[model samples]
Target: MQCRLVVNGFLSSSKFSEIYAWLKAAFEKRGHDMTVCTNIELAFEKTAVTEPILFWDKDVTLAKGLEAMGLRLFNSSRAIEYCDNKALTYIALKDKVPMPTTIPAPMTYRNIGYTHTEFVKKAGDLLGYPFVIKECFGSFGQQVYLAKEPSQAMSIVKNTREPLVFQKFIAESQGKDIRINVVGGKAQAAMLRRNEKDFRANITIGGKMEKYTPSAEEINIAEYVCDILGLDFGGVDLLIGSSGPLVCEVNSNAHFKNIYDCTNINIADKIAEHIEKCMDI
Candidate 1:
C-alpha cells in the first residue's frame, strides 16, 4: 500500500527523527510507496495522487483544512478531535474505569483556591502540593507543572488558555507512571517512567523507563480508554493507583522508538501493518 507518513516539526528534531527513521526503514523494507514531510513544507498538491496520508500529532485545525482541500487522514477527523483534549477524554472515560482527576481553568481563585507550605511554596490547600497543573492543550511533557501551593496552580491557570484542570496528586504513585502503546485497539508495549525527585513522570524530563506488564485490569482500562476516546493509535499513560489502573492522558501521535527500545517491539512495523490491514492495497 502507498503511504505518506506526515510529521510536524523538523526532521532533525530528536523526537521527530526517532519515529521517522523507524517508519522510513520499515515501510521501505515492505516496498510501500512512502513519503515523509513537515507540515508547512508538505506539498499536498503532488502527494494527493500517489499515497494515503497519516498526520502525526498535528493540531486538528490542519486536518480540517486538509479535508477541505480534499485530503484524507488515516484516522477519521472526528476521532482526532476527541483525542486532542485530555480533559475531555478523562471526563468521557472516568465512569467506565479508573481515570485521572482534572480541574478546568478560568475560574475564581476561591473556587479553586491555595495555601502555604515550606516544601511547596504558595500551595493550594485543596489540591495540595505536588498536585498537577496541565495546560489545556499540551503534549510531550510540556506545559505540565507540579504545584505545591494554590498560588502556583493559579499561575498555571492564569497564564494558559481558558479552562484548565487541577489534577489531584497521586502521592502514593511513587513518582512514576505507565505508558501503554496501543494500535488497532490492542496493547503493543508498556513502559514505566519514574522520577522520584520530581512530580512528573514523562521520560523526556529526567525520568527513567523500565519494561512493565499490565494486569488484565490495566490492559482492559487501556483498551477501554482509547476505544472511548476514538484513538486509532496512541500512547495511553496509566497510573497503578490504589483503586486500580487510572488513565492520565492519551497521546494521539505518540513517539514510539524510545518505547520500542524499552519494550523491544517494532511499533513502527505494527503501525505499517495496521495501515495495510485497514487499507485496500
Candidate 2:
C-alpha cells in the first residue's frame, strides 16, 4: 500500500510531530509505504490519485482539493470540518448522542466583535452561572473556560472575539472526564482523566490519566459519535454525568501519545490496521 499522510502547513508542535512519527512508523511496519505531505506541498496539476490519504490537518480547503482529485481521505473532509467546529459538532450529534445543553454564540464580525452582547445575558439566564464557555475551534482544553458568576460569564463574552458556545456545566464531572479512542466504529482504548484543580480534565492541562474500561453506554457513545461523523478514527471525550455519560467533544486527529502512555495501547496501530482494511490493502 502506498499513501500520503497529509498535515498542515506547519507541524504546530512537538506533540504533533511525535504523532506523525508514530503513525508513519505504524503503517510502515504493516508493509505500507507512507509519505508525509504538508498542505504546502499540494499541487493541483498532479494526477494519478492512486494512494489513500491520512489527513491530519484541519485545512478544509486543502482536504477538499485532495478529494476533488479523487484521493480518499481517511476521515473525509466533511468529517474534519464537522469536528473542527465545537458548535457544529453538537448540532450534528445533538439527538444522536447525549451532551450538555449547548447554545451557539451569535454571529459576529471579527473587527466589531460582539457589539450586541445582550445575548450573553440571555445565555447566562438560561445556562446559569458557572456555565462552560468554549471557543468554537480549540483543542487540548486550551480555549475552554468556566464562568463561576454572571460577571465572569459576561466578562468572558466581552473578551472573546471568536465564535463560541455556552453550555451547561456538569459539576459532577468537573476536573474529570473520559477519553475513548474509536477506530472503524469500535472503541479501541479508553482512559480516565482527572485534575484536582482545573475544571478541564485534559491531559495537556495538567490532568492525570489512568487506563480505564468504558461501560457499554460509554462505548456506545464513543462509537456512535465516530460512526455518525464519518470518522475513520477519533478520540471521544465524555463527561460522566449524574444520569449517564454526556459527550464533551470529539477529536478527529486526536493525539494518541497520552493514551498510549497511560494504557500501553498504540492507537496508531489500530488506526493503521483500520486504514488498511478500509483501503483493502
Candidate 3:
C-alpha cells in the first residue's frame, strides 16, 4: 500500500521527528511505500488525494480538508478533534466509560478574559479542593495542574486564557498512572508511569516507566474508548481508581517512544500492520 505520514510543521523537536522516522521505517519494512510530509507542505501545495494518509499530527483543519478531498485517514478527523480537546474527550466518553467527574470551564474569549471566576468556586464545591485543572488542548501532562484551594483554583482559571476543565483528583493515583497503547481495537502495550516529585506521571516530565500487564478490565476499557471515539489507534491513560481503572485520557496521536523503551514493544509495527489490514479490507 502507498501512504503518506502527515506531521505537524511547526514542531521540529527530535522527540516528534524520531516517532515519524520509526513509523516510516516500519511501513517500509512491511513492503509498503510511505512518505513523510508536514502540514505546511500540504497546505501550500495543490496535492491530489492519491493514497491513504497516516495523520500523526493534531492539525484537525488539515486533516478535515484532506478527508473532504476523498483521502482516507487512519484515524478520522472527527476522532482527532474529539481527542485533541480534553473537555470534548470527556463529553464524548462521559456516559460510556468510567472517568473522574469532570466539569468543563465556561467558554471565554481570549481578548475578553474571565471577568468573574464564580464558576471555579462552584466547581470547588462539587469536586472539592485539590482538584485537577487541565487546558482543553495539551500534551505530556504539561497543562495539567492541581489547585489545593479555592483561591488557587480561581487564580489558575483567571490566568489561563483558554478552554479548560475541572476534574476530581484521585489521590490514590497521584504521581502514577497506566499508559495503554491500543491499536485496531486492541491493547497492544502498556506501562506504569510514576513521578516521585510531581503529580503528573508523564514520562516527558521526569516520570519513570516500567512495563505493565494491564488487567482484563483495564484493557477492555481502553479498547472500548478507542471504538467509541472512532479511532483506528490511540494511547489510553487509565488512573487506578478505588473500584477499578478509570479512563483518564485518550490520545489519538500518542507518542510511543517511552512506552517502547519500557515494554520493548514497537507500537509503530502494530500500527503499520493495522493500517495494512485496513487498506486490504
| Candidate with the greatest lDDT versus the true structure | 3
Q: Which model, 1 or 2, shows the larger TM-score?
A: 2
Number of the top candidate by TM-score?
3
Model 2, residue 152: C-alpha shift (Å): 1.4
Cα lDDT tens digits, model 3, 163-249, are 999999999999999999999999999999999999999988999998899999999999999999999999999999898899999
True lDDT of residue 195, candidate 1: 87
Q: Which parts of model 1 are misplaced by more than 4 Å?
A: 9-12, 42-50, 68-72, 107-130, 159-163
Write down the lDDT of every candidate, Cα atoms only.
0.71, 0.90, 0.92
lDDT of 1 by residue, 170-215 (tens): 8767568888988889999999899877767787778889999878
The TM-score values for the models, in the order shown, are: 0.84, 0.97, 0.98
- Candidate 1: worst 10 consecutive residues by lDDT? 114-123
Please, what are the lDDT tens digits per residue for candidate 2 over residues 183-249? 9999999999999989999988899999899999999989999999999999999999999999999
> How many residue pairs clash in each candidate at the backbone level?
15, 0, 0
What is the descending TM-score order?
3, 2, 1
Q: For residue 197, what is the lDDT in candidate 1?
A: 76
How far residue 67's Cα lies from its native spot in candidate 2, in Å, is 1.1
